[model samples]
Target chain A: MIGTLVQTPLYQWHVDHGARMVEFAGYSMPIVYTSIVAEHTATRTAATFFDISHMGRLRFDGPDAARFVDHLVTRRTADMPAGRVRYALVTNEEGGVLDDVLVYHLRDGAHASYRLLVVNASNHDKIARWVDVHRRRFDGQVEVSDLTNSWSMLAVQGPNAAELLASLVDCDLASLHYYTAAETRIAGKGGVISRTGYTGEDGFELIVGANAVVDVAKSLMEAGKNLGIVPAGLGCRDTLRLEAGMPLYGHELAEEINPLQAGLEFAVALDKPEFIGRDALVAASERTDVPVRVGVELSGRRIPREGAEVFLPAGASPIGGVTSGTFSPTLQRPIAMAYIDRSHAEVGTELTIDVRGRHEPASVVALPFYRRPSGRESTS
Target chain B: MKPEDLLYATTHEWVHVAADESGGKVATVGISAFAVESLTDLVFIELPEVGRQVKAGESFGEIESVKAVSDVYSPVDGEVIEVNEVLRDDLERLSQDPYEAGWVAKIRMSDEAALAELMDHTAYQKQCADEAH
Candidate 1:
């Protein structure tokens, strides 16, 4: 038997719905809910809900709270409004990514409600240790707490997501906007709804009482039936992010890689007075000859998988390696991401993917293979 | 599900030796119901190179579903005579009638002795039963 551990909060629900469960990030997550394609298309068109409770949510509070967090994390939390969220990467001393997390400068507190620092599930222990060591140095300023077990997180995403969720929450979910969070009541729970998601769609992440998760999941599924809310599995989550050109930890972000090489220079604020790994990030950016991550779209259906070599047009040898590759349901073709030597990283540059022994032709395209409709109204 | 007069392979291929529209032994090969179920969505299919020579139990082509990539193995020894070109473009046919309209390839038996080597319906059923657990 191909047995892998890690059970999600909805493990039993997954089996009942014919989901093929696989262990990911120490949890047996449903890689597919009903069908991968159906779920992917559903998220693009309507809405989908995902149980991301497996992610780690940490909280920090005290007088020096903002500065303590700003010193270690990429985004300057001191200037961030209470209701807003920021996408940032926490780095090691060597400037490599420790983990990519969304800092929701939440309004909630024990008295004021709460604020959440959502980290990747696999990096919870590592991040907790990092916080403990950093907190000692800034002891009087703030106190760090890991609250991953206190809540269940459901990501409701797609075009019509706001309309579907507004009926359940007490507040106007549509007014929350993107990258912002708020304290609200949903399904009779003290909920923290963040206007954020991995899928590139108009969405919200609902953090509710851990015990009341199943009630919300089932209710949302029933309410959004006509609105097309799919109970997406992790498989759809991966493909959707891939299409939107988002980076995953194991694939795009890793301890050995940094923001400069990962095409995440925009998130790294070099001017942020001082923070961990800033010096190393500067040195990496100065190297013009350094390789940059690029997205590759294969011409054929033969999907180039990870560890596949990329043979640049003018290079004597393979210039880079594939980080992630999938047969895109949106594009109806194979798409892949690779970190090529600086010379071949330019967009529109053609390249060949070494699949086993044969060469499959491809072109370097813009990062995201697909784009979801954003909340900002366009002039056109 | 087709009538169990023929044999099935672990890989989900079924082989039936029936007299062609003409005379010589022709092996009509298709994927089994279990194989069709295993590979849910029928995407791009690489048909066996028509008229190409192939050995018994060798991989003739490839099939891709949403979740996995699977190689379609040959059931018996034969030379590739024809392929279902219709199913190549419209893969949904495989999900519909895997044993009939969804047939993959046809072969001219290279050796008459190879036909008897395949498992019959009863033996193939037993093999499938043993694997379920």
Candidate 2:
């Protein structure tokens, strides 16, 4: 069912800058501006920014907001202090992931608690309705609102991201810790800046008013020109996240794939007092037969795409399938995320992928095929 | 060779027919410049082997970009005589020089009747323009 696609505030800017537009999640989004490899490299080496305005941003307020949110997600959000953000999962009754989101506890200086949820663009409508349907239990004590159309989000990532953003914002961004956000003024407009990103590098995500986003983007570009910052697109974003071993909603996560199977056990707070998927997750935790997610490195350059079957050299039946795969720009080879039998999920176990008609040699490697050098004081 | 001198298939592959020293009709095939540009950032190309028989409009190879995979169809029916091994390592050449250095395979046509099914350069340009819109 294809509906009319909406455009972001930066659509014209993307077009004027030579972006190749593609329809993504009912929006006309840029798949690339210059090139995927170039944009990916810039984010890994220098600095780059992405227009992440399409992601859903939901806000909940009122005295019972924290409890209502904690009931909806797997993480225990009621205890999150102001200015804190946590990665959490929204799951169905069967413990399958509905969406993986970032829960932000904002410090808005209001008497009632304020919580913000950033969800995947593809699952925006679904999660919004899920939150609405469950809000009835709160008996109007908690208020739910959708801020997706009114706000714009951007991510500036790489090793030099902090240094580049420091010149544009009024606050000392270098002081912001990872997974923490602060209210700051950019181009004379108030916004929220968080030191979090999907890339396996240091970065910050900026959320500003939709009307003021174009100005903010221009200012960031002008300030970052000398630092070699490029405008990246969703194509590189997928590669960047895959290299970081992040679970994409539709790939590693789905209605039938729980967080536990996706290797996101840390995000699921099973110890929480009560939640929608608590019972199923509690049962899943004790089970040892579920296929687990693992990283795979192919010996050849041919990429193994999603749905490609995984097998052993001597086995007649497939063990599992690939969830995501790409020719990693950083690793300079083919890498993938696969869900396979837990017994074969070891770091060095040999496997094979049926890439189209050819069976390519692959090995069960560690997740996060690429990791930035440590000892950098300010990266996540 | 200039694109105007070549013929094209509806699938966006360009065909350049020339007589070899042995007086056999050899067709050098590569994806059109328009196709290469649209399939941005080609990461890998699986070329057909030298001695493979391929039918017209049949998928003879695959070209992979960062986001998608597309089949590279044969524009003429023939036996593949040569494949550009250079593309196996440096896929950028396929996008940079799609009409010349990026040629994927060379085929010795067993029958020339398939040439009638192709479009001339002018007609091919119109087809691309319509699809882009």
DockQ of 2: 0.61
True contacts kept of each: 0.11, 0.58
lDDT of 1 by residue, A222-335 (tens): 889889887888877877888889999988899899987888877899888888898888788788776678899988877777899999755569989998887788889888
Clash number for every model? 6, 0
Off by over 4 Å in 1: A1-4, A109-114, A136-138, A313-316, A374-380, B1-6, B19-25, B111-133
Ten contiguous residues with the weakest lDDT in model 2 chain A: A105-114
Whole-model lDDT, model 2 = 0.90
lDDT of 1 at A47: 89
Go through the candidates in order and give each one's C-alpha lDDT. 0.80, 0.90
In terms of docking quality, model 2 is: medium
Give the Å shift of residue B22 in candidate 2.
3.6
| Candidate 2: stretches off by over 4 Å | A1-3, A109-112, A377-380
Backbone steric clashes in candidate 2, count: 0
Provide DockQ values for all models, in the order shown. Answer: 0.33, 0.61
